[model samples]
Structure formats: C-alpha cells, structure tokens
Target chain A: MRIVAALLRRDLAQMFGSGQRGATLLPVLFFIAVAMLYPFAVGPNPELLARTGGGVIWVAALLAAILPLDRLLARDIERGYFDQLYLRGIAEEVVVAVRLLAHWLSFGPPLMLATLPAAALLGLDSETLRTVELGLLAGTPGLAAIGLIIAALTIGMRGGAALAGLLLIPLAVPLLVFGAGALATGGSGGIALTAAISLLLVAITPFAGGAAIRAAREG
Target chain B: MEPARITATDLACRRGDRLLFRGLSFDLNGGEALQIVGPNGTGKSSLLRILAGLLQPFAGKVERNGEVALLDERLPLDSDLPLGQAFAFWNRIDGAGYRAEELRPLGLERLADVPVRYLSTGQRKRAAVLQSNARRAGVWLLDEPLNGLDVEAAAQFQARVGGYIADGGIAVIASHQPFDVQGLTKLHLGDYAP
Candidate 1:
C-alpha cells in the first residue's frame, strides 16, 4: 500500500508539475467540440445521431486515453528512471498498477466531463447518456491499462505510437463493442454486459502490464 | 561491519549474438572500492548493467544484499523538470537528503529550476552525479561517472567517494580514464575476449 501511494504520488506530481495539464485538458475539449458539432453539421437526425453517438464517443475516449501512453515507459526507460524504480525495492506489478491508475486519472476524468456537452448535443435520451457515462467511467481505466502494456512492449522501438495503437486497438475491440452497444440499446441488459466486460478488462490489465515490464527489463 | 553486499559468480552476458563478457567473478565487500577499466566496446557498461540487475546474464548469477545505485552516462532525468526538481525527485523517491546549499559550489544551485535538457553536457553530468551521491545507496555501480565533470568537481567527487568508503560502503566504478585514488583495486577487462 505504501509503495502504491509512493508511485501514485510520484506519477501525479510528474503529470501536474510538468506543464502537461494542458495536454491532458485540451484534446478532450477539442474532441468534445468536434463531437457536438457533428449533429449541427449533419442535420440533427435523432436516429442517425443515436446510432453513431456510441461509436464516436467510445473512439474519442479511447484515442484520448492512448495519447500519452506512448511516452509512459519509453521516456522513463530512455532516461533511466525505470531502472531506478526497479532498484527501489518496488515490485514491477505495483509499478504497473500505479502508472495505470495515474494515466486513468489524467486522461479519464476530462473525457467524462467532455462527454456531457456532447451527450446533450446528440439529443441522447437520459438513459443512454447515463449508460455512456457509466461505461466510460468503468472502461477508461481498462484502456489505460492495455495502453500501458503496448507502451512497454514498444518502448524501445521506432514508430512506437503507431505500433502501440496497432497492438492495443485489437485488444480494446471488446470494450468498444460493449460500450457502444450498451449506449445504443438503452437497455438494462446492455448496461450490465458493458459493466461485466469492463470488470474483466480491469482484471486482465495488471497481468498484461506486468508481463510487458518484465520482458522490457530482461530484454 | 557486514559481509559482501554484492556477489557475482561466473557471470556472462551477450548482446546481439556477440558475447560481451563471460566467466566474470567478483565480490564487492563493504568498505572496498573496485574500478573496472578497459578499452572502448569492452562491455564495461554491459557489465555494470548486469550487476545492477537491469540486465540478466546469459550464464551464472548475481546476488545483492542491499540496494545498489547504478549511474551511467544516461542521466535518466525528465527533460521537463528543473535541476533542483530533478534532485528533489531523487530525494523523494530514494529518500536522499540534499541541500541547495551543498549543491551551490558546483554551480548547480542557480540552475535549480532550469529544465535538464537545456543544460550543457557537463552540467547534466554533474547533476546526475550529485543526485546519485545524494541517494547514498549501500552499493554504487558507476559507469563512466567522470565523463563530463570539471577538475574541481572530479576531486570533490573522489573525496565524497572516499568518505563513503570510510563509512563501510562499497562502490564499483567503470571508467576508461585512470582513477588516482589510493587503495583502489583495478579489474582490467582487456585480457578477457569479448
């Protein structure tokens, strides 16, 4: 627990202290604006908007979650900070967990906040909006976790960003499908399925991240 | 006061199908300092990485009794952080206690808030050394630690190293230049084929 707190504190300090607050906020805001504008430009057709809203929101949120992951372990490995963390008596799993949590915090909340305005713009029913919001709240952490795995695997490579997306997008397919499906269907069963899938994602991320870090350290 | 803090037996490492070093054996006892010297491309850095546990050797094993601080040419500092913040990070993570006053003589105090990427090579190296020393780990594995320091800073670093040894700590330094410190044993890698 103390190790987790230390890792969280260090990562949070780096995120907020390094002038990256804008980087975190601006992209979400831009995506929200673009999402909201889509309805007006495309004629505010309720059926079309409802059908597309789920996919659009999920894609935007996924992209937003992934934007910073490219630099997650690569930056640290290049600078030797990762080596220092390993030597600090902290286990690799804990390091992955803390980083995943930090990434979720930085990238997730703003995405949720930005979604509200777009939700209104899409004329989404209250139930659907709530479903979208809930799905995002539960799902972004999974995205961040999977992103950490891809980040670690590609840390030493050129074109890491592209590789990370290629590696992670396939894994994220289930989450995207469930999240958008839940929002579009507006049924309790859909929401439940989304929640269940989100839970599974949360469970699996730590293992993936752990394996990647270990491979990185050894290789 | 304690036994050897780090031990390696018949350690061997290979990089990209090339054998860097093999059958290397050493024990770093407390209060002793050993220097690893060799020509360029002789796997000095690779040996340090293996001892630091950052890289696993293809053969043999290494055991460390306490925390080992490894320093290389790579500063590993965040480019976004100022010099002081970088030091503060080391203090925060490793519980290294450093004072701004102590760093002033090295001309680092003034650059406390300047991002490390903007600093000159010498300044960056000095800051890395200062941060590593500030940790005061039980075992120090330094690779080319003297690369970018001025003469004065180098002497001060030697003094600090001496003080650290006097306090019953151990250090293994890998460098190309000859170190003039007394009571130091040399481990020459030139005789070992890569």
Candidate 2:
C-alpha cells in the first residue's frame, strides 16, 4: 500500500509539478479557449449559446483530455521506471491504477472549475452549468482511462504522441454521446449512462494498460 | 539473508525475426557472480533480461528463488528532482531507509543535491549503481553496469559488488569490460549465438 502511495505521489507531482506545468495546464487553458472562441465562430446569440454551450464544453473537455495523453506513460517506459517497478514485484496493473487516479485528479477537477468561466463565456445559465459539471464529473474518469490505455499501447512507436491523440477521439465517443446528450435532454438519464460508462472504462483501464505495457516489453 | 538461486535451462531468445542466441544455460547460487561478455548484439543484455524474468525465452525456462534487482542502461531517476529526493522515492517504495553512508563509495555523497539531468554520464552511472545496491535484493541483474564510470568509480563498483557477493548475494553482470569480483565466472554469449 505504501508503495502505491509513493507511486501516486510521484505521478501527481509529475503531472502537477513545475516541470510539467505546461502539460498540466494546457487542458484547462484549451478548454476555456474553446468556450471563448465558440461565440465568435458561431456568432453570439444567448439562446443558441445556452442550448449549445454544454456540448461545446463536453467537446472542449474531450480535446483537452487528449493533450496530456502523450506524456502519461511514454516517459516512464522510456526511462525504465516500469522495469524497476516490475523488478520490485509491483504489477503493471497496480502502477496503471495509480496513474489513472493521478491523471484524473490532475485534469478532471481542474476542468470542472475551469468550466465556471467557460460556462459564463458561453452564456450558459446555472442549470446548464450544473449539468455540465455533473457530466464532466462522471465522464472525465473514463477519458483518463482511455488516455492511459492509448498511451501505453503507443509507447514505442514513431510519432506515437500524434497517433495517440488520433486514437483517443474514436474511443471516447461513448462518453461524449452520453455526457453531452444530458445537456440536450435536461435530465438525469444521460448523466447516469455517462457515469456507468465511466465506471466501466475505469474498471478496465488497469488491465488493458497493464497488458499493453507487458506487450511493449517485447519491443 | 536467505539462500538465492537462478537457473536458466536451454534458453533461446528471439528479437523480431532474428534469433539472438539458443541453447544457453547457466546457474548461479548465492555468493556467486557471472559476467556475460560479448560484443554488441550478441544477446548479453537479452540473456540478463531473460534471467531476470522480464523477458520470456523463446525456448526453455528460468527458475528464480529470490527477488531480482536490475540495473540497466536507463537510470530510472526523475530528471527534475534532486538526486537525493529521487533516490528517496525509490527507497520509500523498496521499504528501505536511506543511509548517506552508502553513497560514499560511489562518491555520490556531495552530489545528492544536484538534479539528475544535470549530472554527467559517470555521475549518473554511479547514482544508478547506488540505487541498485540500496535495493539489497538477493539477486542482482546488471546490464552494462560499468558503461560510463571513471576508473576510481568503477573500482568502487567492483568492490561493492564483491562485498555483496561475499554476503551471499547473486550477481549477473553483463559487460564487455573486465569486472573484478569474487567467485565470478564468465559466460561468453557469442558461443550461444544461433
């Protein structure tokens, strides 16, 4: 348990620390940037913005999630941190789980807070803002999981970072459909489904990412 | 320390379509050391990885009786943090306390405050050696353990490894360079090349 705690500390530090401030902050900045630009791109009209803002936030969050995927697992594998952990009898699943939690903590809640300004930028009222928050709360864990899996799968390839970003969009459709769909319906059903999908993705990340890490060793 | 043993039987390794080596086997008991010597790409590192159980052999098996510590080309230290903090992180995970005295032999006692990325190649290698020694595992699988060490640092490494062997530790060192340690035998990886 202590070992995992140490790993979590390292992961969190790497994500939120000084060295990776750009990677850590890029998602939030990009999320807000998207919200800020939507009014200009589509021509600002309050009703339309209110109706469309939630989906835009969802899309922004999804794209923002992609920003950190490249750094999530590549550096550790390159530097042999995984090999050292394995030598110490730590399973890849355990390390992946820690990374998932850390990755979520780094981006999820920060994006939620950034949504406040983003909602205002999009002229979304309190009700829509609440739904967006709830949807993101439930959906970003799944996004983080998908990011981890993709990062591990692409660890050794040439131009892997670019490839990982391309890979994440298709895998994340389920989260986007359910999360943003909640805004259109103004109900709990879509949010519930989003949470359910998030739970499933989170549950499978460690195993899938672990398998990917093991396979990458063969390279 | 408990008695430790590693035995590789009829081992064959394949990297991509190339067969690196085949029909290679060795056994090392506690207090024993083996140097895997070969030119580049003869499977010296591959054989060490197979013995460490990090890589599966294409043919045959490895039976290990103790936890293995591998010191490969990669340093595994965080480049951003001070060397001491990076080592402390691993020390905490390994459930071992930090002892400054251990860094003296590697001449790392004064460089602990320097960031890992700022350290020179020799300094980085010394820090890696220190980290591996701190693990205190019964079995040590070292790949190119002396790659960038100065003469004094290299001698210190050999002395420390010799001390570890004297205390019933098993070490499998893969290096083309000469390594002086007690009860050490040489395995020519070229002989096993397919």
Candidate 3:
C-alpha cells in the first residue's frame, strides 16, 4: 500500500512539478470545446449530434492519451531512472502498475470532466451523458495502459510520436469499440461489457508494460 | 552471519553487436571493494550493470548473495520532486532508508526542496551516491561514482564508503579519476576483451 502511494505521488509530482499538467489540461479543454462546436457549425440537429457524440468523445480521449506518451518514459530513460527502478528490487510489474495508475489519475479524470460540458453542448440526453461518463471511466485505463507500453517501446526513438500512435491505436481499438458502444447503447449490457473490458485492461497492462520496460532497460 | 556472495565465471557482454568484454571471472566477497578502470567506450558501466543484476552477461553467470544496490551513472532522480522528496522516494523500494537529519549537515538539506533537475552535476552525483548507500545492501555496484565530484565531495565520498566497508558492506566502483581508496582492490577491465 505504501509503495502504491509512493508511486501515485511520484506520478502526480511529475505531472504538476514539470508543468505538464497545463499541457495536458489545455488539450482536453480544447478538444472538448472544438468537438462541441462541430454541431453548431453544421446544425443543432439532435439526431446528428447524438449519433456523433460518442465517437467524438472517444476520439478526443484517444488523442489526449497519445499526447502524453512521448513524455512518459523518454525523460526517465535519458536520466537513467529506468535503471534505478530495476535495481531497487521492486518488481517490474509493480512499477509499471503504479505508473499507469498515475497516468490515469492525471490524464483520465480531466478527460471525463471535459466530456460533461461537451455532452451538454451537444444536447445529449441525460441517459447519453451518463453513458459517456461511464464508458470513459471504464475504458480510459486500457488507453493509459497501452499508451504506457508504447511509450516504453519507443523511449529512445527519434520519431516517437508517429510510431507510438501507429502502434497504440491498433491496440486501443477494442477500448474504442466497447467505450463508444456503451455510450451509444445507453443500456446496462453495454455498461457491463465496458466494465469487463476496463477490468481486463487494468489487469493485463502491468504485465505488458512491465515486460516492455524490462526489455528496454536491458538494452 | 555473512551472506554468501556472487562469483562471476567467464562473464561476457556485447553492446550494439560489438563484444564489450569476454572471459572475465571474479568473486565479490562481503565488505570488499573492487574498482573497475578502463578507457572510454570500454564498457565499464556495462560491466557494473551486469554485476548489479540489471544486465545479463552474454555468456556468464553471476550468483548474488542476497540483495544488491547499483548506483547507475545516469543518477535516475525525479525531476519533478524537490531534492528532499526525491531522496525520500528511495524508501518506497526495499532496502532504501536513511536517517533524515543526519544527512542535513551535508549541505543536502538546503537543497532538499529543490527539484533534482536544477541541481549541479556534482550535486546530483552526491545525492545518487547517498541514496544508494541508504539502501543498506551487502554489495553496491557504482558506475563512475566520482565522475562530477569536486575534491571535498570526493573526500566525503571516500569516508562514507570506507565507513560502509567497516560495517561489513561491499562496493564495486568504476571510474577513470584517481582517489585515495585504501584497501580497494583494482580490477583493470582494460585487460579483458568481449
């Protein structure tokens, strides 16, 4: 429990300490505002707005997730923190899990918060708004987990952004599917599937990210 | 009782398709210090990581006594943390703890609240060494422990390291700089090839 706290604190400190919080927050706000405005530019048609809201939210979240991957392991790799992590006798899985959780706390919550205003702007029904929030809570962890893996894989690459996005978007397909599906259906079954997928992502992310980090450190 | 330590037998390593070293064998006993000296690009850091169990040798085995602490050259500090907070982070990992007030007099306390990224190279190196010592392990593998230290800091480092040895701890330091490291056996890695 202490270790987990320590990890969480470290992640939060990194995000705020380095002023990365502002960078992350700005994009989310911009994305939400821009997405909301799309309906205004076209028309205030409820059917069109409702049909597009889920995909826009998911896409915005995906873009936000990608924005931070370049910063994740890159700095640590350059400063030799990754090697320090390995030598500290902490299991790689624990380290990866802690980092992923921190990413979610920093990047995931603000995304959900921003989604609320966008949902309202798009004139989403209460049911649709609830679905959007629930789907986000359920699916963001998987996005973070996969983002972390790609970050580790491309720690030292020259053109990391293009590569990380290419590698991660494919893996995030299931997350996008389940998340958008839940928001679109506005039913308990959709919520259940989203929850299961989120749980699976939370469970499996550590192993995948841990293995990648270990391998990268070894080289 | 003293814990059994590792014996490296015919250890070999390669970096980027080139062999760094090969046919190397040695034993690290408790309370012993070995200095690995070599020219640039000779893989001294690589050798230290292998000993610390972070890197596996291409063709050798390293049997560890128990837990090992490695002070990597890159001093992995949390740039977002105040210096003190970064030091405190060591506690999260097993075998990493320290007497907070005792370290205050070392001038580290003044900079405790400063983020690690703002520290000078020598200061960062000092913190890295101190943090590694905090781990309280039987064996410490330090890669270029004295790289950026000034004369006074070097003396302080030697004293601390000597005290660690007196307490039955072991250290292996890799450096190109000379220091008065008494009773430290030299392992000239330049003589070996990958």
Q: Go through the candidates in order and give each one's DockQ.
A: 0.61, 0.88, 0.59
What overall lDDT, based on C-alpha atoms, would model 2 receive against the true structure? 0.90
Q: What digit string (tens of lDDT, one per residue) describes model 1 on residues B1-194? A: 24448898998888878887778888878888899999889889888888888888889999888778887888867778777776766666666456877687566888987988899988988777776656667888889988888888788777777777888788898998877565688998776665
Ranking by TM-score: 2, 1, 3
After superposing candidate 2, which stretches have Cα over 4 Å from the reference? none
lDDT of each: 0.77, 0.90, 0.77
Cα lDDT of model 2 by residue, A1-219, tens digit: 899889999998888888765779898999999999999999988989888889999999999998988889888998999988998889999999999999999999999999999999999999999999999999999999999999999989999989999999999999999999988898999999999999999999999999999999988
Residue B56 Cα positional deviation in candidate 3, in Å, after optimal superposition: 1.0
Off by over 4 Å in 3: A16-21, A183-186, B1-4, B92-97
- How would you order the candidates by DockQ, starting with the best? 2, 1, 3
Best by lDDT: 2
In model 1, the runs with Cα more than 4 Å from the true position are A1-3, B1-4, B101-107
Index of the highest-DockQ prediction:
2
TM-score between model 3 and native: 0.91
Which model, 1 or 2, shows the larger TM-score? 2
Sort the candidates on lDDT, descending order: 2, 3, 1
Model 1 CA lDDT for position A109: 84
Cα lDDT for residue B112, model 3? 78
lDDT of 3 by residue, A1-219 (tens): 776787777777777565454866765876687776788787988898878877887887887788788887788778766666666666778877888888888788888888888888877777888888888888888788788878877866789878998898888888888778776566767667767877787888788877777787566
DockQ for candidate 1, C-alpha atoms: 0.61
